[model samples]
Target: MKKNIIFDLGGVLIDWNPRYFYRSVFNDDARMEDFLSTCCNSEWIVAMDAGLTAKENIARGQKTCPKYARELALYDEGWHHMFGGAIEGTVEILKDLKKAGTPLYALTNWSAEKFPWAKKNFPFLDLFEGIVVSGEEKVIKPNPEIYKRLLARYNLKAEDCVFIDDNAANVEAARALGMAGIRFTSPARLKEELSALDNRPSHK
Candidate 1:
């Protein structure tokens, strides 16, 4: 039986960081950090990833912190500028896996509205046999339902998949469901981990 390798898009295959784009908006690093932590935090962004539209997200942010309305607006307007591009080394590994006939799929926590932009900007995303976007499903990672949805929708078995994610909680969730899970640190390390898996009898 061939093993399926599931990948996380942001932080693993793609470089995505709000700070990358926000640095130019806020001159002071400390102030930017404060604004990001207080006004446009991860918790708020996760709501967007879970299916909230950019317009709604911006409106909510504005309501929460009207003083940072300009910054909140930029989150929607300059959203494409947030991506730093593909992690080339990890992309190389993905290509090698494809060349070797391994099945590839992606499970990403991304806004449905924003994902089209990423799909347009990143060519490698086309390589996946299938992808499950959280925003499209109205569920995010670390949630068992989303993972189960991916497996069920694709007719894939948990035991036959190896899930890779940058978040420890997400990785653990995959493991909990009986799939091999890897907590990605760097591309080089990811390559090493996958290589080790390739040598295993189950993967063969």
Candidate 2:
């Protein structure tokens, strides 16, 4: 029986709209994408989130794109925009699930630096039974290790847990680990998926 629900922070719960920086105010997706493609995918920041070097990452992000540093300045600004509050129906769905006595958890590949801002701004996420952020562990999701750790913490069997993430690679990773997963697209679709799960009454 499924007793736990895990969620992805960005895109799934919070809306990650990168387009917010450009179309609304600045014309910078092209620049940001270029920077992300080059230096943003560093393991050092990953290590920072895993609770490694706190000061190192701040310096690294600063140092990574020294030549095109202004692009980095907008990194925080861009993320703030992409991350809107929780999806409209998500808060209500979480409230309903909580009331129904369901066990809910959050598993996100978040940055130690950025998520604090998110937590400060969004409290709905504070309701999870547990939150596993990659930045804290220096290990991101879809990395089988992180999933395994979450399973162990919840004392859950893969079949008895369903994960929802905004990224396809994340969803695939969950399935690869023998768990059920849904790739979240919209609040309505997520609602439908959750509602469908409620109707089925899983047992395993």
Candidate 3:
């Protein structure tokens, strides 16, 4: 079977970062960094991504950090400000793979509430044959169960899939589960690495 390509959406294909939105929210870079690190950090995001509704997360954040209530609420209200657009180089690669008939899929750690916005903004997301979102599943990556869910749902053998993720832990999890893994750094590097993987003789 031709290798099925699984992509991690955020850093790999979409340029999503709270910093982009927060930069405009706070005038001082130091203050912005401190606020992000303190209240609206990655840990908080993980909870939202792991099936907690944005409304719930925002409320919890406000309760825990009342000083930043406005900022926390803005996290959901001004959510569109977080996007920097598609990584065009990676998008071009996706188009090429589509042309070559490679089965494509996405397994992303994204909030379910905000995913509709992404679907509307990024037409390229439609290229995927399937998308397993962490928020929808209530499970996040670097966890073997989530990976298994994707394989089982798609009826895909782990060995037949090539998972690409920007997070080292996520890529390692895929590799541990018998899927070929690529730690995505740049689109150029990804293209070269994927080409090399494709050229290799399949074990089956």
Candidate 4:
């Protein structure tokens, strides 16, 4: 049987980096990096991905670093600027998978409030048969529950799916759940991996 393919949205299909937009805000690269690393870091962003509302996230940031309250607010205020654009290479792969009649689903650790902007900007997201947003589900990846939720929601067997993610931790989590996991380094590598899997027997 053909394995169902699941994709992660940010960093994989989309070039999402806060630095892309923060450079303009801070003007100085060093300062921008410091602000991002200290105040609005990945840990804080993950909280938002785990279903914290924009308002709450911003407030939490402001409370943590009162000095950068104004800058912290910009996270939600200028959220749309964060996305650089679609990763055309991965998107091409997705299109190819779709054309080949592969079952496609998205399991993304994305903020519910910001996901709409992404959906509007990236039309390729519409190609997925279904997408499970972490923010919407109140869970985040590298956590087994979110992966289990995706499998259950889609009526998919974990052993019959391939999960692709840019984060190694997320990939490991998927593997732990019995789904073949690919730590996507590049679209070219992913294409090669998928081709290799195509010829191999399914994992028991």
Candidate 5:
């Protein structure tokens, strides 16, 4: 049987810059420090990915500090830019996986707003068998609950799938659940890793 391959969006498929917005919106050292301290963690984005509306999230950003509202709106608008670049070899790798009949999915922690930007920018994702975003599911990664939900959704055994993620914590969570998980070091390395798996049963 072919194994399912799950991808994380931000780092695995779409290139992400951790400080893109801060660089764009903040010129002050103090405000930048404050912004980074208050509104820059994955949790805030995860909350939106887990189903909080973008409008509300902008408000949430604003509530963090009066200066944040405008920047937050820019954050929402520039999300496409935030996640615009594709991993160099990802398209080819995904194509090969499809050719080999491996079931493919993407499990990313992104808000409901992400779909529009992603679909508009990288519409090819519609080709995948499943795409789960935590914002849509109200769950986020590195939390055991999200991995369980993915397993349950596909009715898949924990060991029957391989998860690829850039974050060590998320990858470790998948492994802890008995799934095969690999760290995504880079697009080139990712292709090398997935191609190496062709020697396994799923590739056959």
Candidate 6:
């Protein structure tokens, strides 16, 4: 069977990092790193990924870390600055897959409130037959349930899907559910790896 391709948005297809935006704010790498690690870390942002509204996360962040109130507010207001841009190499691969009539789907850990902006800005997103968003589903990757949801919603068999994600844990989670999991490193590497799997059954 031709395997269905499922992609993770951030880190894989889109170049997104809070540091991209914060670099401008702090203008100092060390200061920015300190702030991100100490005050507004992944814990603070993961809440939004797990379905807490960005507005609510910002408010709570500001209340808890009053010293960085302005920065916290800017986190949401200037979230677009976080994008570096689409990974052109990977995008080209996506276009090729689409041209070949491959069934594509997207599973992303993103905020529900901000996903609309992503859909509007990234035209390449239209290539997907379906998308499963963590924020909307109130579930994030590395959790088996999120993977299960994607398979269930799409009526896809795990053994017939190719899951690609930048995070090792997320890839492992997909593998646990019987899907072929590829840990994204770069577009060239991904292209090579996928080609290697062309004649084989779905396997990591």
lDDT by residue (6-83, candidate 4, tens digit) is 999888999988888889998999888889889989998899999998899889889988988998888887778887
Give the lowest summed-lDDT range of ten residues in model 4: 195-204
TM-score of each: 0.96, 0.78, 0.97, 0.96, 0.84, 0.95
* 73: Cα error in model 1, Å: 1.3
Cα distance off (Å), candidate 6, residue 9 = 0.4
Q: Which stretches of candidate 2 lie over 4 Å from their true place?
A: 22-66, 74-82, 201-204
Those runs of model 6 whose alpha carbons end farther than 4 Å from true positions after fitting are 201-204
- Candidate closer to the true structure by TM-score (higher is better), 2 or 6: 6
Clashing residue pairs found in predicted model 1 = none
Q: Model 3: which residue pairs collide?
A: none
Cα lDDT tens digits, model 5, 85-193, are 7775777778778888889988888877667777778766876888877877787888899888888887878888899999999999999999888898877888777
Selected candidate, larger lDDT, 5 vs 6: 6
User: What lDDT tens digits, residue by residue, belong to model 6 across residues 68-145?
Assistant: 888888998779989999999999999999999899999999999899999999999999999999999999998999
lDDT of 4 at 94: 98
Q: List, residue by residue over 56-80, the lDDT tens digit for candidate 2.
A: 5546677756865564555555656
Taken over the whole model, the C-alpha lDDT of each candidate is 0.93, 0.73, 0.93, 0.91, 0.78, 0.92
| lDDT score of residue 123 within candidate 4 | 94
In the order shown, the candidates' Cα RMSDs to the true structure are 1.5, 3.4, 1.1, 1.3, 3.0, 2.0
Alpha-carbon deviation at 125 in model 3, angstroms: 1.0
